[model samples]
Target: MKSFEKELPENYDALKKKANYTSSWRDRLDAVTTLSAYQHEKVIDLLNNRMKNDTVFKVQTAAYKALVAFGENVEKPTPARFDVIKGPNKIFLRVKKSLPKDHTVEEFADKLKRMRLDVYDAFEGDKGDQFMTWLEERWAKL
Candidate 1:
């Protein structure tokens, strides 16, 4: 029986770009899943990079899973104590100050999206469907 090894796809460069797009954890996580289809060293290295250094825990976990699926020896990355959003309390305060006292959480979320897309994206990715709930909880505290 002849053994078959997966070859790098023509879209490898595009996938690489997605994997390295520092601003979007969703892109990086999707890239890890997409890269898992190939059995090439380049893909392995890219997954390794994400596993070791992605600021988002979800992206890092996706990369670790991909590498494990590829039969690579890797330790699971620790869950991040903090999210990619630095000083979220400060950001929340800024957003609060920008809004009227009677502003809704929806308004706050919209303002956050407009003001700090990085923070918005991180929370959205991290919280998934619970993003709104989390936002409301935080807003209540503010």
Candidate 2:
């Protein structure tokens, strides 16, 4: 098996190709994580779907980790007033509600951590044999 770093795709198309050919749990996980780094909403959507249905334990774990990394990278710091430079392929979260924009970087980091915790709480589940069975059922539908 190729190392995850060695197998990482260079672009969206490459990622898709790799995903299609992925035969090992690690390969699938690497594919999702590599695609997530691109930060494109389309890639994120694809990874999310895979995460939901991937029968491989490592692949799902990698997908979740990649999602966390994607959120952290894309979410702008608070004092910036939600002003964001959306990359050509990436999505940005817009702030609809007004709030105090005078926050230090440390505060922003803390807030990001809290937000991450909330997300984790929503997605928490056992990653055991039962989960593997669930994944297999889900994957069959996909």
lDDT of candidates 1 onward, in order:
0.85, 0.45
Residue 115 alpha-carbon offset, candidate 1, angstroms: 1.9
Off by over 4 Å in 2: 1-10, 72-142
Strongest candidate by lDDT: 1
Candidate 1 Cα RMSD after full superposition onto the native fold (Å): 2.8
lDDT of 1 by residue, 1-142 (tens): 2232479889999999998886688898888888888878988888899889877789989889877877889999987776556679889989999999999999999999889877887788778888899889988998
Residue-pair clash count for candidate 1: 0
Candidate 2 TM-score versus the reference: 0.40
Residue 25 displacement in candidate 2 (angstroms): 2.3
lDDT, candidate 2, at 127: 32
Those runs of model 1 whose alpha carbons end farther than 4 Å from true positions after fitting are 1-6
Q: 115-141, model 2: which lDDT tens digit per residue? A: 443221221232334533543343233
